[model samples]
Structure formats: C-alpha cells, structure tokens
Target: MQALYDVPAPAKLNLFLHVIGKRPDGYHLLESIFALIDWADTLHFERRGDGLLQRHDSEGANLPPDDLCLRAARALQQASGCGFGADIHIDKRLPAGAGMGGGSSDAASTLLALNRLWGLDWSLQKLKELGLSLGADVPFFLGGTHAFVEGIGEILHPVTLPEQRFAVVKPAASIATKEIFSSSLLAMSKSVAIVAGFPAHNSSENKTVDVTRYLDGFGKNDLQKAAEAASDDVVQALELLETKFGNSRMTGSGSAVFARVVQENGKSDPAMATMLQEAIPAGWQGRICRSLEHHPLKGWARD
Candidate 1:
C-alpha cells in the first residue's frame, strides 16, 4: 500500500589502505580514506502490504539467496517494529569481490531507504550503528560523508574531499582482503607516518590532515604489491594504468586499479579517460567516475 523508491548503492574506492596492525580477533587495523564514486549498483524497494521481503534482480544472479540486503531489511524491521515489508529489486552494476564494497553499499542503502519508507525515521547515528553490524564499509556509506576511517573502520571523521575524476579498471580476478592481510609478504610492521600533505606514498594521516593538500599529493596502497604478486594480471593492469595516466593505484586489496585524470583537454592533451578506456586490456573492465564528497543518502538523512 506504500510507494516504492529506488535507492543507489554506490561503489567506493579506497584512496589508500594501510594495515597498521592485526587485532586479536584477526581483523586488521586499517587506516584509509574511502571515497565514493559515481558508479553504483541500484536497489528498488516496494513496500508489501503482506509484510514479505522479496528480492528480484536483473544483474546479480550469482549472489546467495540469503544476502545482506534482505538481512538489513529484516534488521530494520526488528529494530523499528515498523510492521511493514517490501519487495527489494537490485540492479547490480559493480563487480563482486573487487573491493568496491558493492554488496555492503546495497545493504546500507536498503537500511537507509527502508528506515524512511517504513516511517521509522531513525537518526543517522542510529542507522550507522545498525549498518556497522552488516559490514565494515556499510557504516561509512550510512554516514554518507567522506571519512578518515580507523579501528577496523568503525571510527569515522567526516571529511570534504576535492572534486576529482577517476578512471577505474578491474582485472578479471578477485583478491580476498583477508587473504592479503594474512599474507607474510603483506607490509605490517611499517611505521605510521605523520603526513602533513598526503599519505607517505603508503601511510595513513590523522583527521587534522588537510583535504586539499592530500589531493595534490599522491597516496599509495600498501597492500597493492602483495596483491599484485598473487595475481600477475593485477600487476599488468596497474602497469597499463600508470603508463597511461601517471597517477594510478590499486583500491583496497584489489583487482581494481584506478588512475586520477583530468576530464578536460587543455595544452593539447588527450582526455585521460578517453585514452584509458580505449586502451583497457581485453580481459579487464574499466570505467570513469567522479569522486563525491558526499553520498546520495545525505539528502535522505533525518538530520
């Protein structure tokens, strides 16, 4: 009897991921600035008068039936006692296991949208608390702001990132973050840097770090060399992006590599985006996305 709404589950690119230490529970302590991109998977929520949560999809047949999206809806229902249900449809665009946080974003969006659609009217802090139980990255998406994240990513300091365009390429394989973190070759004992401008080629900065200064400075992925060593295709793709765009880095423990590029052509330069897409390897996927200082859900927040 209620209207259906389409919610976006945007993909994230970890500007840099630094594994500082391993927790006793095996979750690694990480420091990274997670940036949301324009590319996203979308979820549609249609309230069911019958109180049934149904999911139909045009893109993601591979995800298991008991997915986080449904779980999130159930979580909201139990948390709010809204006495409402919905049919959720997913239009998945981002690749799975590519470290883009596609599923987690979907779960976050589902919780946020349903909180509104079901008339629960929960606060952002409450939504983020619920989202954290779903996934590490889910809290960040629920916060709907760019953040300097720490403590296995529960701690967040909202940040304003400069508007920049990115060219992202995903190799044909997925690198598990857990596997990479547990690898002996992964850099663990490296001293954290007190970065004034940007991450020290591969370090994390505190909340006081200036956002503009960091943008001009190049950040590095500490797990990249290790992940690339596990997959030669990742190494090859990184090389292609760097050779073409000059500022390329792997996002998270990644098969996805992204490059910063200028959209406009001045001084007789080829559009970096146009060049990268045309040169994408035969077995790889690529897209151009503009960085966002805020997530779409910011508009929906109860404030």
Candidate 2:
C-alpha cells in the first residue's frame, strides 16, 4: 500500500475584506488579501487497490460521512480518469465555521496530494479549475500565497505581506456563510488603503515592507455588521478582543475574531498571546498566529 503521511492544509485569514459591488447574479465583488497562517489541519493518505475511497479520523469521531476531502478526491478521479482510490484521514485542528478556510484548504490538499499519489501530475492551473468547481476559496488555497482576491474569488494576484504576530479568538459559535451573505444588513465597503511603507500594488515582484500600521486602519470587514447581528457570540468576542487589543475584526464572515499583538513598555514579548488569552473567556479558544510568506504547498504546483 502506498501512503502519504502527515500532510498539512494551512488556514488563512482575510487581512481585510471589502465589497466593492454586486454581480448581476447577486454574488458580491470583493477586494481582499488572503494571508496564510501557521495554523493548519493534518491529513494522512493510503492508496486503496479496490478503487474505494474511504476516510477516517485519527482523533476519533468528528468528521462527517460526506466532506470536501471526499468530494475533492472524487472530482480528481473523474477529471483525470484515475482508476485508483485512497483512504484519507484528517486530523482537523482549525475549527469549522470559523471563517479560517479550513474545509477549503483540506479540499485543496486532497486534490494536490491525490494528484501526486495517483501519478496524474496535473498542472496547478488545471487543479485550480477543478478547485474552483469545488468552492470559491479553493482556488486561493491552490494558489498557495498571500493573494489579492477579486470577482467573487475567481481572480487572484499574489501579494507580499509583512510578517507579524496576531492573536486569534474563536468563541463557541459557528457562523454560516450562506446566512451572513443573504442578510439584508450586509453592505459594501468603499475601499482599502495602506499606511506607511507598504507598496500599493499586489504583485510578487513588488518590494516587501512592514505593514504593522497598515492593518491598523486597513479597512473594515463588509460582513462584520451582519456577522455581529447574526451571532451574539461574535459580538461578544469582538468586544472582548477590542477592549484589550484596541481594534478587533472578524475574519471571513466568521464568529472568530483577531487582533495584532503590539509591543508594550518598550519590550516585545512572544507570550503576549497568552496575555490576550487571559482576557478572553476560558470557554473560547485563543492562540498566537504568525503570517506565512507563502503556503507550504506553494511549490507543489505551477500557475
């Protein structure tokens, strides 16, 4: 039996999400930078000779019968005419409905891993097209870099982002994307601007500069208002983070909130996330996350 062990699917944060307009079909036009973070979900795969796709959870009993991992495998199988199937086991770390793009990342990882495992050697562009059919966020995960995303997520341009530490909080609440997108309270944000030394364009060739202050006033999450209204847990989580970190924003129509950790008293500390955790409710989960320059699988495929 052939297998891949301990493969990772990293999570992402939306530095800022701005809704510029709406499509004729009612999908929203967006301008946002998706940043990869160190937080990730791990997956293990073993090839099955019987052409049967199966899944299991190492942690015992959390995954559903039908999930994106299964769908992704099936999609790739149908696309490349591969006759082999595999057993996919996921060790889920990122929470669901947290707006951290966990499921999409898992799905993308499945496609990439299987493409290699099955020896199809599909190009990144071909995989991305398959990913898009799976989900809008899937392409961004496939792209494997911080990106300037637009056009309801079909368009992507790699962007250089500053490295900074962020504290994330996910209250005991699940936010449904469909519910938030359909809300009447959702509104469009005008535009986004960077402060200090950051470059204005989203390109790989562009110079990289510190964006510590760029995120301070970057822009508002267009869905924040609607998310807060939909989930009182989200409202409380943001309020708690804001009280300690000065400003807090929800990531990707989620109940999860995040704030930058700044130096205090002329000294920088790595344990500040612990301090931030002390301020939040014990029932909520908190962690310090560092932004990644690119996704772990960035080199796996070509665009």
Candidate 3:
C-alpha cells in the first residue's frame, strides 16, 4: 500500500517473427512468440499523495521528461481517475532500441504495479487495454507468459514453452524500429493478407486455439535482413553468434541477435553463458537468459 519494491519488467525475445501480411490501416499482420526473459528492469514505487507523478532513475535523479514509465503513470492516473500519485524509481537493465521491448515492458509494468499501489484494482483486461494504448508490445507483457502475438501485438494467446536458454547480444549500433518497419525488404515482401502457413484458420480469433505445433515449426525473424543491412554491427554480431552457436536469429525488429545455447545432448549448455559474455565484441552487450514460464508480476491482475 505504501511502497512496491523489486517489481520487475522483464525483457522479451521474439522467438520468431513473421510479417505474414499487412492490414488495410497499414499495420502489418504479425505472428511471433514473445518469451519473457530473465533479463529485466526493476522498479520501485512509493506513494506521493499530492497527485503528481514523477519518475526517477534509482540514483535519485529524474528520468527524461517523456520516458515511457512516466507516460504510463500519467495514462493510468487519467484512466482510473485516481486521486493519488507515486514516485517511480527504475533500475533499467534492458538496452534501448534493441528490440527487446524494454520501453513497452516498463510501461506495462507501471500499469500493473500502480493498479495495486493506487488501489484502482483494475482487471487484467483493463490493464491490457491501457497497455495497448502505450505500445503494441505492452499487451504481450500483460499476457503473463510466453505468448503467440498477432494483430500488430494487441492479440495474445498464452502458450506453454519448454525451458530454454538463449544467448542474446546487442550490437554497438542502433537501428530504429521505424526504419525496419519501412525497409525496402518488407515492402517487397508485403502481400495480400494471407497467412501462408495456415491461411484458412489464420484469423486472429481462430489462431488463438493452440500454438504448440507452431512453436516447433522452423521459424525465422522477418526483419533480420533489414536489420543486417542497416547496421554492420548487427551483421557482425549475427555472424559471430552463428559461428559459435550453429544457429542465430534476430529478436523482434532488431539490432540484437540471439541463439539457443544447446549441448550435444540437445539440452541447454550452461557454460556458454559466461563464455558468450566474454566472447562478444568489446562494446557489444551479451547475456545468457532463461525463458520465463510466467511474468514475475503475473499475479498483479486477475486472469
């Protein structure tokens, strides 16, 4: 009631992303599984009864005037008409613009944490609705576990996933998400709305049935080509990962690439985590992450 501590907004890896089609409104139709990762951003919240929302980095300095965390707080305050406010302090771990959904996750975590701290007690449905307004990826974070995301990420189907380990790397270069969405490759690849894999049942509602089989399907990130073209750092990182891990792919619309750390027995290789951190380029960031079965803040709202 007074403060919330150690609340986490975990990063996500889009196990695979496909730009299957585009909508009439220009939003691309998408299919991907967003798996929560152990890498996370942590936040602490304390009550500020004067109804003024402020966000600070953990070092006690205010964050940028328009950081998503602050925006989320303002949005939630407006949505709930709550007469209370909070002082938000974030311990940011996820890198910006790495396609790891850091900003969106922070916004979603703000919605979830404040829903309780403010006692608005909004249902997950309400929280997700607010989340969608903040960013497309926010709903997937609110979905509580690994999810089959569709309809530009607003639609989510929670799915079970086998425990897995990933070695994720963020290149020294930055690739804007807007550029990836508008890249020439996507323009050439866009087509009439057809879900080639299962066209007949690809409608959003129908696709929610089950994703177990699709998870095992040979999936690839649609935006990787564009990412590689946009940054030499991305290309170098991907090449290194592929050489070391035998396979690698970009996550989301990325400058970040990831590969499963697999052993000869097909289980995840534990030693690779530390080795990767040392092997990655001098300025590049790398970490080994385990996929989460559920969001750390899963119980914050009703299912």
lDDT for each candidate structure: 0.79, 0.81, 0.80
lDDT of 3 by residue, 126-204 (tens): 8888888888998888878787777788877666777777889998888888899899876333321344433232445
How many residue pairs clash per model?
0, 0, 0
* Model 1 lDDT at residue 154: 79
TM-score for each prediction?
0.89, 0.89, 0.89
**Worst 10 contiguous positions by lDDT, candidate 1:** 197-206
- On lDDT, the stronger of 1 and 2 is 2
Query: Positional deviation of 51 in candidate 3, in angstroms?
Result: 0.7
Clashing pairs in 2: none
- RMSD each, Å: 3.6, 3.3, 3.1
Error of 2 at 97 (Å): 0.6
Q: Cα lDDT of model 3 overall?
A: 0.80
Candidate 1 deviant stretches above 4 angstroms: 59-61, 189-193, 196-209, 263-274
The residue-by-residue lDDT of candidate 2 on 70-132, one tens digit each, is 999999999888988898888888888899999899999998888878888899989999999
Model 2, C-alpha of 156: deviation from truth (Å): 0.4
